[model samples]
Each structure stands twice: as C-alpha cells, then as structure tokens.
Target: MLTVMRHELNMQDRSFSTYLFGFFLLETIGIAAMIYNINNKMANFEYCLSTITLVFVLIIPLITMKSIAEERKLRTDQLLYSLPLSMWDIVLGKFFATLVNFMFPMVFIAVYPLLFKRYGNVYLLTSYGSIIAFIFLGAALIAIGMFVSSLTENQGIAAGISAVIIALNYYSLDLANITSSTKQGSLLVILFFILIIGFIVRSLTKSTLAGVILAALLAAITGIVYLIKSDLFEGLVPSVMSKISFFQRFYAFVNGNFDVTAIVYYVSMTAFFLFLCVQSLEKRRYN
Candidate 1:
C-alpha cells in the first residue's frame, strides 16, 4: 500500500493534469472569494464554497479519469495484481494519493477564514465546518469517480461519465424539487431508477440472472405495496432524491449547521463505493 501510494503520488507530481487540477480549483476559489467576500462584502467564506460547488463536475473527472482507466489502457492493472498487495491496498493508495493532491489547494483555502478574520467578523466555526464537509464530499466523489474509472479503459469515457454523474448529483435536489409530487410520478421515477440499477448490477457482476431476479423481486414488491397503499408513494421520489443528494447534504454546513449526519453519510458513501471498486478489480483479477 505504501509503495503504491508513493508511486501514485510521484506520478501525480509529474503529471500536467495534476497541476492543472490544482490550478483550476485555486483559481475558482480566488474568483469566488473575490465575488462573495470582496464585492458582496459577505463575511461567510462558506458562500464562496457554495458558489464554487459546480467546479467539481469538471475537477472530479480531471483527476479521476485516468486513475484506473489509464492503468487498464496500458495493461498495467495486471502488473498491480501481481504485486504483493491486496486490491484494498491498491484502491486505497490511489484514493489517498489523489485526495492528498486535492488537499494541497484546500490548505490554502483553509487560510481564507483566518485571513478574513483580520478584516471583520467571520464565522470561523461554520466556515471551517463547511470546509471539512467539503473535503468529505470531495472524498466521497473521488471514490465514486475512481469506481467509474475502473469500469472503462478509455480515460475520456471515464471522465465524461464522471462529469455527468457529478452534474446530476450536484443538481439532484433542484431536479427533485421540480419533479412531480404525485404518487404516479413518484412511482415512475422509482421504477426508472430501479431499472438503471438493474442494468448496473448486471454489468458490474456479469450476472444477468442475478440482476434480473433482483430487479423483478423489487418491482414486484413495489407493485404489491403500491396496490395496497398508493398514498405511501406520494412525493416519495423527491424525498428520496433530497435525502440521497450529496450537494444537499453540503448545504447544511453552509447554513451554519455542523451536521454530523451529513458527515456520516459522506463517509458511508465513500466506503460503499470503495468497496465496489475493490470488487470491480477483483473481477478482473480472476479473469
């Protein structure tokens, strides 16, 4: 694990994309600080983070696109399997290396609250809390991006898919708000997501029977439940979307609330996706 971490970090140090990712994040923070802190005379640095959340859509892919995709492209994943390391070690090493690289700019961003404190009232507690949660959110997304990378050999495809997923997650709450509150609408939405999950389960495990049975079982249960109590599904889709959205969780910190639940949610997401990543690699290892 240490060897993989060191190698990954060394590679990042020499990679142009690594520098570019830092440059872009730092630049976005600078601009956001200027707008929210200077022009608007806002004391809350968290506002800057809120405004710049969209940057992750691009940055997530920027770093994660090539993580596993490039390894597979060059057939280096086989080399990794032969190493005296478990899949957990390799996945965690890559994840921590990329996360450390991300934290480089965050170190500067952390100083912003202190710098602003000199000028006037800055809510350091909430400000720092938001920053911490932001890093957790980034950690979760980085894990997700790596899983996406593990699914493909082409960096561009991985990057594109990651960007789309980030964009959707970033706007999930907003999208949910606009979606129908009707039971029928909610049912449709639930069924749609179930179908997508079914396809995903099939692709990832390479088990059509497993996916089909799981999907069918869930659908049948949903149908029976709906028939018995249709009112239970009223606005269910929007509620689930709001609950599951990563960006929605971040808003609690922005609102001066140090939400422990959100932090736990982010950590859970990171772990779940990292587990999937290990499984993805395990599939290829045996093949």
Candidate 2:
C-alpha cells in the first residue's frame, strides 16, 4: 500500500497534470478568499470556504481522472492485478495518495482563520469545524471520483462522469424540490434509479442476467412495500435526494453548529465509495 502511495506521489511529481490541478485549485480558492475576506472584509472564513467549494466540481476530476484511467491506459493495471497485494491495499493506497495530494493546498487554507483572528474577531469554533467538514467532503468526493475513473480508460469520460456526479450531488437538494411526492411517483423514480444501477452493474460485470435479476428484485421489493403501505413513501424521493446532497450537510458547520451527524455522513460516504472503488478494481482481476 505504501509502495503504491509512493508511486502515485512520485507520478504526480513526474507529470504536469498534478501540478496543473494544484495550481488551478489553489488559485481559485485563494482568489475567493482574498475577495471575500480581504476585499469584502468578511470575518467569516467559512463563507469564503463555501464559495470556493464549487471549484471542486472542476478540480476533483483533475485529481482523480488519471488515478486509475491512466493506469489502465498505460496497461499498468495488469501489473497491479498480478501483484501480491490485496484489493483493499491497492484501493486504499491509491485513495490515500490522492487524499494526501488533495490535502496539500488545504493546509495553507487552514491558516486563514488565524489570519482573520489577527485582524478582528473570527468564530474559531465554527470556522474550524467548517474547515474540517470541507476536508472530509473533499475526501469523500475524491473517493467517488476515483471510482468513476476506475470505470473507464478515457480520462475525459471519467472527468465528465465525475463532474456530473459531483455537480448533481452539490445541487441534489434543489433537484429534489422538482420531484414528485406521491407514493407511486416515488416508486417509479426508485425503479428508474434501480435501472440506472443495473446499467452500471451490467457495465461493470458484463452480465445482463445478473444485473436484470438484481434490478428486478430491488424493484419488486420497493413496489410491494409501496403497495402495502402507500403512506410510507410520502416525499420519499425528495428526502432521499436531499440525503445525497453533499453541500447540504456542510451547511450545518457554516451555520455555527458542529453537527456530528453531518461528519458521520461524510465519513460514511467516503468509506462506501472507497469500498466501491476497491470492488471495481478487484473485478478487473476476475474479468
């Protein structure tokens, strides 16, 4: 695992892609912070952080697009598959490598609160909490991005999918508002989601029957439950969609509440997606 991490870190140093991503990421965040904190005289660094978080939609793909896609493109993944390491080791090494690279700029950003404290009163607790949440959120997004990268050999395709997924997650709360609230509507939406999941499964496994069976079983269970109790699905689609909104959870810290639940949610998201990445990579061995 450490070997993979070192290799990835070394790869970043060897190529211009990693530095390009880091440059853009830091520049955007720095400009935002400068405009808000210095020019605008805003005391709340968290707001500046919030404004800059949107840049992740652009930068995260850069960080993760080449993690696995390049490995596959270079045919290095074959070497990884034949190595003695377990899937978990490889996945975690790659994830943490990306994570460490991601954390580099954040280290400088962390000093913003102290800088603000020098000028005037800064809400240290809330500011630092939001910063922590922001890091976790970025880590989780990187995990998701890595998994998206693992799905394809084309960096552009991985970047596009990562952008779409991250953007949707960022705006999921707003999107949920447009969804139907009725039980049958929720059921149908869930069925559609299952179909999408089936598509992903089929793409990954190349097993149409397995994907169909899994989707059908899940749809049948959801349909039966909706039929048995129509009331249970009231606004369920919106509610579930809301849960997927990454920025929504971070808002708690921005609002001066150190939300433990939100922190847990981010951690869970990171772990879940990391697991998916491991599975995706592991499947290559069998495929």
Candidate 3:
C-alpha cells in the first residue's frame, strides 16, 4: 500500500493535475478573501469556505479522474490483481495519495482562521469547525470520485460522471425543495431510483438476472409498503434527500454547530464508497 501511495504521489508530481488542483484552491481562497475584505460585515471564514464549496464539483474530478481509470486504461490493473495486496490496499493507497495531494493546499487553508483573527474579531470555533467539516466533505467527495473512476477506463468519462454526481449532490437541497413531497410522488421517485440502482448493479455484475431480481424485489417491497401505508411515505423523498445531502450536513458546521452526526455521516460515506471501489476492482479480477 505504501509503495502504491508513493508511486501515485510521484506520478502526480510529474503530472499537471496536482498543480491545477493547487491553483484552483489558491484562486478560490483568494476570491473568498477578496470578497470578505470588501464586505466587512461578513467576517466568518465559513462564508469563504461556503463560497468555494461548489468548486469541488470541478476540482475533485480533475484529481480523481485518473486514479483507477488510468490504471485500467493502461491495463496495469491486471498486474495489481496478481499482486499479493488485497483490493482494499490498492484502493486505500490511491485514495490516501489523492487525499494527500488534495490536502497540500488545505494546509494553506487551515491558516486562514489565524489570518482572520489578526485582522479583526473572528469566531475561531466556528471558523475552525467549518474548516474541519470542509475537509471531511472534500474527503468524502474524493471517495465518491474514486468510485466513479473505478467504473470506467476512460478518464474523461470518469471525470464527467463525477462532476455531474457532485453537482447533483451540491444542489440537492434546492432540488428537494422543488421536488414533490406527496406520498405518490415520493414513491414514483424512489422507484425511479431503484431502476437506476438496478442499472448500476447490472453494469457492475454483468448479470441481467441479478439486477432484475434485485430491482424487482426492491420495487415490489416498496410498492407493497406504499399500498399498505401510503401515509408513511408522505414527504419522505424530500426528508430523505435533505438528510442524505452532503452539503446540507456541512451547513450545520458552517452555522457553528460541531455536529457529530455530520462527521459520522461523512466518514460513513467515505468508507462506503471506498468499499464500493474495492468491490469494483475485485469484479474486474473475476471478469
């Protein structure tokens, strides 16, 4: 794992991706700082972090697009499968390596609170708290991006899909507000989600029967529950969407709440996607 990590880091150093990521982070922070300076009424660093959060939809894909996709593209994944290291080791090594690369600029970001303090009254607790949340959010998104990369050998496709996924998550709160909250509406939306999940399962397992069976079972169960107790699903879609939203959870921290639940949610999300990445690689070995 360490060897893989070192190799990835060395590769990143030789490539432009790391530099591009750094430049984006620096530019985002600069813009945030400038905005804050112009509007002295907005003194919180969380505001700056919030302003830059959407940029992750673009920047994270740049770093993670090649993590596993490039390996597959070059047919080196077969060599990895032959190695004694488990899939977990490879996935984690790459994840941590990309995380380290992402963290390079974050070191500079961590100092922003002190700089704000030097200039005027700053809420250190909330500022640092938001920063912590921001890091975890980025880490979780990176994990998601890596999982997306594992799905495709083409880095461009991986990046595009990752960007779309992140963009959807970023705007999920607004989406939920606009979406129907009625029981029938929620049921239909959930059924649609189940179909999408089935497609993903079919793609990953390459088993139409497995995907059909899983989707049918889930859809049947959901249908039965909806028929039996329609009220149970009232406003369910929006509520669930808001709860699972990554940005919505982070806003708690930005609002000065050191929410333990949000931290756990981010950690859980990271672990879940990393596990999926491992499974995706393992599937390749079987194929």
- Tens digit of per-residue lDDT, candidate 2, span 237-266: 999999888998888899999899888988
TM-score of 1: 0.95
Q: Residue 147 deviation, candidate 3, in Å?
A: 0.6
Query: For each candidate, what is the lDDT?
Result: 0.93, 0.88, 0.90
- lDDT per residue (tens digit) for residues 128-193 in model 3: 899889889999999999999999999999999999999999888888899999988999999999
Where in model 1 is the C-alpha error above 4 Å? 201-210
Rank by TM-score, descending? Answer: 1, 3, 2
After superposition, candidate 2 runs with Cα above 4 Å error: 197-212
User: What lDDT, from 0 to 1, does candidate 3 have?
Assistant: 0.90
Worst 10 residues of 3 by lDDT: 34-43
Give the TM-score of each candidate.
Answer: 0.95, 0.93, 0.94
For candidate 1, which ten residues in a row score worst on lDDT? 278-287
| lDDT by residue (tens digit), candidate 1, 1-287 | 87888999998898888899999999999999999898888899999998899999999899998899899999999899888899999999999999999999999999999999999899999999999999999999999999999999999999999999999998888988999999999888878878988998898778999899988988998899999999999999888888889998898999999999999999999999999999999988665
User: Is candidate 1 or 3 superior in lDDT?
Assistant: 1
